[model samples]
Target: MDDNDEDNERFVRLLRQVFRFLHLVLHVLAGVFLTAILVGLQRRATDPSYRSLKRWWLHRVVKIIGGQVSVYGEPAPVGSLLASNHVSWLDIPLLGGQTELTFLSKSEVKDWPVLGWLAAKSGTLFIERGKRDGAKGASECIAKRLEQQERVLMFPEGTTSDNKNTLPFHARLFAAAVTAQAPIQPVAIHYLNMQGQTHPLVPYLTPQTLMQNLWAILAEPKILIEVHFLASIDSQSVPRKALATYTEQQIRLALRLNSA
Candidate 1:
């Protein structure tokens, strides 16, 4: 192509990015405002109606952000525990859009600006990492949610990683599934660009603030997300550590990564 053609193409791409960014900001603000109203009417944290609203709002957010999600397998029953790999902050909206599940997030997320408020309203369970009894409390909370027939989604990696590979699963949260006799559902998440290759812009890695990540995503034309729900394991049949290992292996294999 000639220089003029290249310059014209770049200009068009820049215009698209600007439009996407504005759409995202407006859509997110509207969704959050409506969600806050619904949250006020929610009688309890686990109310089904409130969860449905959250799902609707999340779906809208995903669409506004130019995300297209494709699911491979069915999610486990309503009360099961979903163990997934952490790839990006977008994982929450991607999964939550299709499932009625509460997320297990780090306690620090409770301090984030708009996201923290939305997460809290959506019944997210925050874990205070590095605290002496944090895991114990989080485990008990997960068990209670499972026992009550609510699906709880936790990223056992304990932190986000590049979408290229799987990380080691933390065993603490698995104890909840075992204690509650809940089935463990393994999920693998991958982000791709318009060409269908793994996308590097999605991961919320260190030194990148939420605003920076949001801008990066909005600047992209499209993001394709794939979610695979692998076979469910009976928590009653294995110890917590074993359960964690088994689930991680299942997700790793699904993502085509070598098992650790």
Candidate 2:
């Protein structure tokens, strides 16, 4: 291509990125305001109306961020536990938009700006990651919620990764499913750019602050997220460790990765 043509293409791309970034900022601000209003309502956390509003807000955020989600299978029932691979911060809204489940997040997230406040208002469960008995306590809490017929979503990887592979699953949280006799549903999440290839920018890995990751995602012209819900395993039939291993294997196979 000619020099002028190349320069013009670059300029156009820059303009698009700026537009997307602006759009994301506007939507986030609006979401924050709406979340404040929801918090003022003083509805119980498990109220259906509360969850519906949160889900609607998440749908708007996903749209503004230019993410297109494609689901391959149906999500498990409300009383089940959803174990999914960790990809990005976007995973929260992506799954939230699709279902009314409460997420299990690190306690530190309660201190993050805007998003943390919204999460707290939405009744997200926070666990202290480094505490000696944190997982056991969190598992008991999850089991009680399951007994109440509330679905819970957890990322057993304990951290995020690039979308190319699955990390080892931590088995402690699986104890909740066994205790509650809830089915364990394994979910695989993958992110791709407009070209249908995995995009390195989507994963919120080490050394990348949330803002940097957010900007990188906003700059992408298009991001396609695929969520695959594999078959549900009966939690009562197997021990927590075996259940965790089986769930992890299902998710890996769904993502086309080897069971390592």
Candidate 3:
């Protein structure tokens, strides 16, 4: 390559490295802030103070990550079910940063560090797999939450995947919405890279080492997270199976992600 071309390449590389360094520093500060908020919330779970602090902390985290989340349609009623396709662990704070809905996650997540603690304190529901009655019990619990006018965000894919394709929504969870007569609100989340290109880094994680994966993500400059809320399906109109199928379809269409 010519001298000028080489110089330009070097400059771009330097800029990316500098941005990465800044990103890392910001992440450290955000983590400290999130932890402090979660701990404080834990101490005062019975009062409204915890929710207030959590909202502020989450908003700050969203700003720190340069993540711009846009809600497409009007939010459903307070007791409505907010369902979405699972992309990555980042979906927690990314979505939670927008709204204060409790998440329904796999039981394994309860073993995670600060995240697990925060989720638990925030009243997240953890489902244990490999148990016959687990689904039924969890559904009942979700129904109870809905009846109390609390929003529950569930990923019916049963596992996270690259947002490029949508997974089949687990029909079991929809039963809770059916029993509670709560509407199901579909949402789509997409991640764009620095050049505005779609990158798999959004849902990038593996069974081997989630921590290492998260660290690598922390080292990156930025990832754009989009949360698109779709139309709500009235429980009286759509059956559980139909609700699951329709939601999966709408989410795929909204984000142009595959739902195969």
lDDT of 2 by residue, 82-198 (tens): 999998888888988998888999999999988788788888899999999999999999999999999899999999978999789999999999999999999999998888988
How should the candidates be ordered by lDDT, best one leading? 2, 1, 3
lDDT of 1 by residue, 1-260 (tens): 99999998888777877887788778778768878777676546577677777888778778877888889999898889999999888889899888888899999999988878878877899999999999999999999999989999999999998998887888988999988999999999999999999999999999998878987887677799899999999989688889989898999899888766
Model 1 TM-score on a 0 to 1 scale: 0.94
Per-model TM-score on C-alpha atoms: 0.94, 0.94, 0.81
TM-score of candidate 2 relative to the true fold: 0.94
- Root-mean-square deviation per candidate: 1.6, 1.6, 3.7
Global CA lDDT computed for model 3: 0.75
Tell me the tens digit of each residue's lDDT in model 3 across 1-260. 99999998777656665665576467656655765765765554324566665656666555654466655666666798999888777777777767667679888878887667766766789898878988888999999999988888899988887767776788888999999999899988887777877665557546637655554555456677777878888877567898889888998989875556
lDDT, candidate 2, residue 147? 92
Any residue pairs clashing in model 3, and if so which?
165-258, 166-258, 166-259
Ranking by TM-score: 2, 1, 3
Displacement of residue 252 (Cα, Å) in model 1 is 1.0
